[model samples]
Target chain A: TQLLEQSPQFLSIQEGENLTVYCNSSSVFSSLQWYRQEPGEGPVLLVTVVTGGEVKKLKRLTFQFGDARKDSSLHITAAQPGDTGLYLCAAPSYNTDKLIFGTGTRLQVFP
Target chain B: SAVISQKPSRDICQRGTSLTIQCQVDSQVTMMFWYRQQPGQSLTLIATANQGSEATYESGFVIDKFPISRPNLTFSTLTVSNMSPEDSSIYLCSVSGTSAYNEQFFGPGTRLTVL
Candidate 1:
């Protein structure tokens, strides 16, 4: 079974602080995605990285796919209280449309 | 992107009871996925629902416990039978986009609390 492990299962930081969350897996994936989920809501797509060593930026958030396609990372610059939520990394299953999600990193940006 | 909606946004039910959650997508989709998110945990894929076919469940999940129905391309239902305290979680419905890269779009999610 393929699994994606996330570093720092929980994080609590002051507003304006920057943080990085890593997602690593022993198996390679065709594509990787990042999602942010707020309380009482499903996760929202943040970005998708398909190529090895690919980097995509969305405003204050930057996402990178590792050179081997077995890892990814999400970095938030100057996080705000609004950024507090659960961040998850997911990859598509081989020969299937299903997605395998990481354990997740819960971020709490307190003011 | 498709607009997805789940019925019974939140429900509180007694243990041993059953609940069926409905998911509707604005646009027709080829594949619909059901996921479970335990409190303070990431989403785990429960099964994949396809129109006119038996739903494919992931390992550790069985068809008897989680029955899924996909009568059409735009609608599906998932029933949690004989629920217990461990069944309390957020159930989310999602669909993969038709583009080259299959990006998933999710519904607001149905929060289930078994008492």
Candidate 2:
């Protein structure tokens, strides 16, 4: 089985600060997806990185896929209090529809 | 994109009881997945529900504990049987997209507390 581990299990920052979270895997994958989940809600898809070295941006957030396709990162610029949530990275399980999710990063931005 | 919804947003139940959560999608999907998450943690996939077959559970989960029913292309149900404190968590319903990248959308989740 493939494993995904995320770094900096918890993060707390003041509003307007910038931060980055990472997700690493034990094996290469075809694609990777990023999600942010707020309290009482399920995770919402943020972006999907299909190719190695791919980068996608959503408003103040930026996502990058490692050149080897074995890792990924999410960068938040000028974070706001609304950005506080649990961030996760996931990939399809060997071409199957099932997903294997990351350990998770909890970000709290206090305004 | 597929819009997903789950029933019984939050429920507190007694031990040894059972709870059935329903999931509905606005559009047809090939596979629907069930996941469990702690209050402030990540997702752990429980099983994959296909329209016309039995659900495929992951390693740590069993059918007896999480019986799934996919009655149609756009609806599914997950039941937590003989609940215990350890079963207290958020259960989410997800459906895979048809894109080449295979994006997935999630429901609002059902917060379950077994006391």
Candidate 3:
């Protein structure tokens, strides 16, 4: 079984601060995705990293896939109140057609 | 990416009753997935809805409890049958692009509250 563990399950930071969330797993994956979900809503895909050691950025948010494809990271720079939400990492199964999601990190960026 | 919509954004139902949530995607998608998210917990995949074939459920989930149907490439439904208080959660439907590895777009989600 492949499981993704996310560190710092909950985080509270003031505006302009920066923070990073980590997602680690024992099994390698072909691709990994990051999502941000607000209350009473489904997660919206932020980015997908397929190549190992790849880094992608969306405005102030940056996502990185580990060199081994077994870990990933999401970093938010100069956080704002709008950045407050739940961050999730998901890796689609290689042999099967399913997505394994990480534990998730709930971030609160206060103004 | 696709724009997906789900019906009954939030509902309150009695235990032992059932509720069927509908999912519609803007574009045709090959794969649709159902998921459940309990309070303060991560998402858990319930099943994969196939266009023409029967839905494939994951462990700890059965068709008898949560029946899913995908009649076409752009739509699907998930029925929570014989619900209990524990079944109260946010149900989301997701659709993958052309390939399984493609990024998935999710619906707004149906928040079910079983009394």
Candidate 4:
């Protein structure tokens, strides 16, 4: 079984601060995805990284896949209150439609 | 991108009773997935619903407890049987895109509370 563990289960930061969340695993994956979910709503896909050592940025947010495809990271710059939510990293199961999600990192940005 | 919607956005039911959640997609999809997210936890896939076929459940889930029906490409339903307090969670419906990336899109989610 492949398990994904995230660092700093809870994060609280002031407005304009920067933060980075990490997702690590021992098993390789064909693809990796990042999602952000708000309270009482389903998660929305932020980005998908399919290549090793690949980095994609969305405005102030940056996502990077590990060189070995066994880990990924999400970095947010100038964090605002609107960026507060539960961030999750997911990987597809081998030859299956299932998605294995990470432990999750809850971010709270206070103004 | 496909738009997905789930019925009964939130429900409070008594233990031992059952509740059925409906998922509808704006466009036809080859596969629809059901997932459960307990309070303060990440999402766990319940089953994968395919058109005209029996749903494939995950390791910890079963067909009897969580029966899924996919009558067509754009719709599916999931029933939670013999509910308990532990069964309270948010149920989400998702579908994979037909693009090369196959990114999954999610519904608004249905929150179920077993009393």
* Local distance difference test, candidate 1: 0.94
DockQ of each: 0.79, 0.84, 0.76, 0.71
Per-residue CA lDDT of model 3 for B1-115, tens digit only, reads 7999999899999999999999999998888999999855699999998899999998999999998989998899999999999998999999886655767889999999999
Model 2 spans with C-alpha error above 4 angstroms: none
Clashing pairs in 4: none
Model number 1 iRMSD: 1.0
Please rank every candidate by lDDT, starting with the best: 1, 2, 4, 3
TM-score (all chains, Cα) for each model? 0.97, 0.97, 0.96, 0.97
Listed for each candidate, the true contacts retained, as a fraction, are 0.72, 0.86, 0.72, 0.64
Per-residue error at B83 for model 4, in Å? 1.2
lDDT tens digits, residues B1-115, model 1? 8999999999999999999999999999999999998977998889999999999998899999999999999999999999999999999999998766667999999999999
Worst 10 residues of 2 chain A by lDDT: A91-100
- Regions more than 4 Å wrong, model 4: none
lDDT of each: 0.94, 0.93, 0.91, 0.93
lDDT of 2 by residue, A1-111 (tens): 799999989999999999999999879999999999999888898989999999999999999999999999999999999999999999887857677899999999998
The candidates' interface RMSDs, in order, read: 1.0, 1.0, 1.3, 1.4
lDDT for residue A76 in candidate 3, whole number 0-100? 89
Q: TM-score for model 2?
A: 0.97
Tens digit of lDDT per residue, candidate 4, span A1-111?
899999889999999999999999999998899999999888899999999999999999999999999999999999999999999999887777667899999999999
